[model samples]
Target: MLRALCALLGLTSAAIAAKFELSPKKFLTLPLGDIKPAGWLHDQLQVQTDGLAGHMHEFYDLVSKSDWIGGDSYYSYLEEAGSYWFNAMVPNGVLMNNSIINEKTQEFLEYVLENQDATGWLGPEVDTEKPRCLWGRYPFFFGAIQMVEYKPELTARVVDALHKFVKLANRMLRNGEGVDKWAATRWEDFVLTLQWLHDFHPRGEEELLVDTMVRLKWSGVPWEEVFSEEYFPTGPVENLTNPFGLELSWHGVNMAEGFKALPATYRFTHNQSDIDAANLSWDLMFKYHGRPSGAYAADEMLAGLEAVRGTELCLVVEAMFSGSYLYQVIGDLKYADRVERMTYNALPATLTANMWGRQYLQQQNQVAAQNMSPNPFPEDGPYSNVFGLEPNYPCCTVNFPQGWPKFITNAFLVTSDKKGLVQLYLGPFEVQTTLNEDNLVKVSVETFYPFGDNLNITITATKSYMHYIRVPSWIVGGSMTVNDGEKTGLVPDEVTGLLSVTIGKGLTKIALHYPAKIVIEERPHGSIAVHRGPLNYAFDIPRSEKIIAQDPREPHAVDLQMGPIGAWEYALDADPATMSFHNEAENDDHYKLPSPIFDSGKPSVSIAVSACSIEWPLAGDMFVTSPPENPECLGDVKTIQLVPFGATKLRISEFPVFAHSEPSLRVGNSYQIGDDSEPVQKPFNPTKPN
Candidate 1:
C-alpha cells in the first residue's frame, strides 16, 4: 500500500529537469523539546513559557473559550484570529520526540480532535454568522503538522482529519460554494499545507487530495502571474497618503506566505520557472520595501525603506516560515541567514525581556516604544507600539511565540541520506537525533554566537557520521579546528557554497573561529547601518518604561509603554576602520548571572566610538526618523556605546556617517581584524542581492 502511494506521488521523468535533492531523506521536524535550548536560548524560552504565552488561554478568551476550536464566546464562531492563536500557542510545553504533559495543551488538543465530525469539520458548529471556513481550517492544518512531532500519537488522526476536510472542500468547490474572501489571499498557505501532507503522509490518496487542494486554491488567486516581476512592481506602493494597499502581493503578510507557493510547488513539478518566480518575488520585496532589521515594511501593506515605518509581527513570523521552507526545498544557506537575522533582531526587540508583553508593530530605527497619534504605520492604531497582552491586535500576542520554537526545531537537521547533520544557524543548542535509526548522534554546541565569534561543538555518537556547517557570505577566510588542532580553510560547494565535512563519531571536538569586521550598509536616502557578523549594531537609547493598568480587575490588561530618556541623534565617523569593538562582559561567568540570564540593559558586546550630536529629530513619524545628512557638530566627538540590535527596545540602528571626520583607528582580536593592531579590517563591500 505504501509503495503504491509513494509511486503515485512521485514526479515523472519530464518533471525532473531542475530538481535538487533535499538534505534529509524525510522532511521531519523534531518533536517539541528535542532540540533543547542551551545557554541564553534556554533562558529565553523559559521566560516565554513561564509568562503570557504559556498561560494566555487561561486569561484570554480568544484561545481559552472561543466558538472556534471550542473556545468561549468572545468571537461568535471559529474566526481567523482564534485559529492563529491556536497555531502559535500550541507548541508551548511540547518536548520534541516526547509527549505533551501539560494539561492545558493536552486538553485543548483532545477537545478539538475528538469533536471532529463526520463531515470533516474540526471547529465549532456552523452558524449564520460563522459558516464553515476553509481559511479557519488552514491554520489548524498547519499547526497540526508543526505539533505532530511532539504528539506522534495523533499522527494518524491528523492525517485522517486532513483527508476528510480536503474531500469536503473539493465537494464545496465543485458545488459552487466558493472559497471564503479572507482565505483567498492566503491560498499559498493552503497549498503549502497540502504539499506538506502529501510529503509526510504519502501512503493513501495523498496525491489526489493535494491536487484537489491546489486546484481549489488556484481557482481564486492569479498567484502565478502575481509572483512574476511583470505583474508585481518592484518598489514601495505604500506612502503617507495611501497606506492600506489592496493589491494581494502588496499586503505584507500575504506576500510573506505567498512567496512559498511556487517554491513548494517546484518540489513536485521540478520546474525552473517556479524557482525563478520565488526569487523574483523576494528580490522585489527587499529591493524596495526591505528593513534594516531583516524585515520588509508593511504597516499592513508595502511601506518604503525608511527606518521609522513599522512592520507587523505576523509578517515577521510568516517570513521566517517561508524562508525555512525555501531553504529546505532549494537547499541554500541564504534562506538560513535571513531567518537568523530576523530571529536575533526583529523577533526579540518587539517583546519584553520577560516575555510578558509584546508590540503589534516594530520599527527598524525606533527611538521610542510608546503609543502616539500621527504615527507612521498607516493602517495600525495609535497603540501599535505599546507592549501589552494585546496592543493594536491580539494576533501578535499569539503569533510571536512561534518564532523561537520553530527556530530551535530548524537549528539542526538530518541530511537527505540520513548520514550527516546540517547545522543551519549558529547559537547555543543541544540536539539528539538518529542518523539512520541505529546510529544515535548527540551534539552540544556552545557559543555566545552573534555576541562573540568563537563556537565550540562537541559530538558524541554511536557511529561515524558526516557534518555540514554554514559559513555566512560575509566571512572571507573561514576556518575550523579539530580537537584543538590547527585551523584549516574550508572548501565550499559550487552551487550552494556551504561548508561541508565528514567526521568520526564518539566524542569529537570542533572549534570555529572567524574574525568579525565592520561592514557598512547603505540605507535609503543615503543613511548607514553597521554590521558585524550576523549582529547589527544600534545606538542603545536609555528608556523609561511605564506600565499601565487598564483594568484593575483584569491584571493581564496591563501594558508597557517606553520612551527615550536620552538623545538618540548621533553621527559617527564615516570610516568603518575607526569603530572600536568592546566586550564589557568578557570576564563575568555566563552561568553566574544574578537572576534573569540575559541583561538587555548591559549587552555583553558593545561598540565604543566618538560621535557628535546631530539635529535629527522626531516628526509626525512613528518614532524618530533617520539622522540629518550633515548635522551641525555640537561639540567635540564624545565616546558613546552601541549595542547589539536585538538587546535594545529603543534604538537608532540607521545613522548618518560623518564623511569629513579625521580617521581614528582602533582594533580588537576577533574574526579577521585589519592591518592595524586593533582588531579591525577593511570593509567588505557587499552588493544588495537582485
Candidate 2:
C-alpha cells in the first residue's frame, strides 16, 4: 500500500532508482542581462564585436557565402565557424551591452530554428561520400545549449532538435561512419554534449544515448588510462606511445578538453580513479609543456617548455572551459586559480588592447610580433603573430570570442545546494539571485582586482544567508571586515582556498584587504618570473605597429606587425620587495571607479625596479629566447619600468638574477642584493650559480 501510494504521487523508490541527483547542472547560470559587465568589462565586449570576431563575415568568403551551409564546400569547418558567430558571438554582444547586433542575432536564430529539416539534422545535408565529420557537430551544440539559457522560448525546439540529432549520431557511430577522423580525435567534446543533454532532459533513453556515446568515445582504452600514460612529450606527435597514435592527447586542444573527460564520465560511474587520473594528467602536462602564462605549449603540437614556444588561441579558451567544468564537477578551488591565471594572462596577451586584432599563437618571451620564415611553431605558418583577423589559422577567429563572454558568465556561481553563492572568478560585475525561494540576495563587487588587491562588496539581502568567497591560493595574511565588525583574519582552506562567512538581513558592506607583494619564481633555465597577486610582471617593452597587408573588402583582416621600441635584456638588480607599483588611478578618482582594467587600452599599474643591463642573446630572426646563463652585468644599475605581462604586446617575462656582493641578501644557492626597502618574506630561491 505504501509503495502504491508513493508511485501514485510520482515519488520514486530510492532503493531501485538512481535518485536523479540534479545531473551536472545543480547550479544555474544567470541570464545574459542579469550579471552585466560593467566599467572596462563593457568596453572590452563592445570592442570585441566591433572588431574581427564580429566583423569577419564582411571580408571572408567562408563566413559571408550562402554556400557555406547549404552548398557543397571543401572547407566545411567554415560552416561550424558561422554557427559559432550566430550561436555565441552575436548573442553575447547584445547580452553584454545591448549592442546593435540584436536585430541580426534574432534574424539568424529564427532562420536556423524555423528552417530545420524534418529529419532533424540542422546543418546542411551535402556530399554523403565526404567523411561525415562528427567534431563539427559540437560547436553548434554548444551554441544551442547556450541559447536554451539565453532564450527560454526556444528551449522546446532546441531540445527536440538535439534529441533527434543525437539519435542520428548514435546510429552513424554504430555503423562505423562518424568514428574515424577529427571526431575520433577530439571525442571528449562530443561526449560532453551527450552528458549535458541527458542531464537536461532525462526522458528515459537520454541516459542510453549518453552511455553509448561515452562507450564509442572510450573505444577500448578507458580515458583514465589514456590520461595516466607517462610516455608523453618525449618527441613529435608521431612518437606518442598510445594506440591510435597522433590522435588524442598529443594535440594541445585535445589535451585541454580531455581534462574534463574523466570527470564527466565519473558522473555516471562514480569512479574515484577518474578524479585521481584527472589530477595526475594536469601535473604531467605542466611538468612537460607548461608555460609561465599558466598554459601548456602547443604550437599545433606538443611543444616543450621553451619560453618562446607558442600556445594556440583555441587552447586558451578550451583550457578555461575545462577548468570551469572541473571546478563545477570536482568542487576544487585550485581549478579556479588556474582559470584566473589563464584568463588574465594568456587570453589577453594574444589580442590587441582594443580587441581589434588577435594572434594565432602567443609566446611568453615574444620580442617581435611579426612573421618570420623559421617560426617557433612546428606546423604554423610564418604569419603567426601578424595579429590580423586570422593570422596563421582561422579556428581562433570563430572560437576565441567565447573566452571573455563565458568567463564573465561564470564570474558568480551558486553553491551545489542552491542555498549559498560563491564568486567563482573575480572581475568588475554584479550578481543578483534569490536564496531559499523567498530571500533575494544581490551583491555588487567593485575593484580593479588583479591590478589592485582591495575589494569592496556591498550586499543587499532580504534575509540572512551564507556567502562563500574564494580566497586565491596566492594570497597570504589577508583580512576581511563586515559592517564595521571586528576585522578577522581570513582563515582560508589550505586546499581549496575558500573563506566562508554568514551575512544578516538588510544592506551590509564588506571590505577585503590583501597585501600585494611581488614574489620571484625560478623558471626552467636560470631565469625568474616575477608575480604579484595574480598578475605576472614583464619588462615594459615599447611597441610600434606596422601594417603588412589589408583586405580591400573588409577592414578587420589587416596583417599588422609589432616591433619592440625599447631594450628588453635586463637582470634583476634589487630584491622583489623593493619593486614599486604606480598607476594614475591612485590619484584620479574617476579612473579608480571599478571597471575591468584592459578595456581602456591603457594599463594603469606599472612596476618600478632597479635593474642592470645583461648580455642576453637572441635566437635566429632576432627573436628573444631563454635568458643566458648568469652573465656579468653590462651597465650600471638603473631604475626601469615593468608592466603587467598581459599589458605588453612584446616583452621578455623571465630574467636572469644578478650576483651581488651583499651578504644578508644571499638566496638559496647564490647571492643577490636588496635596496634599503623591506624584502618579501618568501622570496624565490636563487638558482645555483655556475
lDDT of 1: 0.68
Model 1 agreement with the true structure over 1-690: per-residue lDDT tens digits? 222322454544455322222222233355565688887677777777777777666667666654444433334224555566556656656632213325655665666677778887776564345446576666666667766766688888788777777778777766656366556667667777766666677556654654564455454555566666565655556443322233555678887877777776676556667787777677667767776677778887777777887888888988988887777767665667777778877888777777778888888788777778676677778788888888887777767777887787777776666677888778889988877758888889988777667779998889888887877655546679988678897666644545776677678898987656666667765577777777777887888888864535357557988888888788876666667887644555553222233346545777776688878877764357656776777777887877778777888888886664433432221123345544222232223431
Name the regions of candidate 2 deviating beyond 4 angstroms.
1-28, 65-79, 219-223, 234-244, 593-601, 660-690
lDDT of 2 by residue, 1-690 (tens): 323433442334541125433245434455555566665666667777777767665556656645455445534432456665664565466455545455555655565666656666566565544655666667767776766776778888888777877777776665666655455556777767777667667567654554455555544224565566555554345334555454554778777777877776555545566678777677667666776677778888777777887889889998888888877777676678778888888888888776767899888888898878566566677678778777887778777888888888777777766677777687677777776668888898887777767778899889988887888756656689999899988876555556788888899898998655555666667777776666777875777888888888866567789888778888885355556767666656567533234532367777787788888777767578687767678879888877777777788887777853334444453222344264333332322100
What is the C-alpha local distance difference test score of each model? Answer: 0.68, 0.68
Per-model TM values vs. the true structure: 0.88, 0.89
* Candidate 2 TM-score, true structure as reference: 0.89
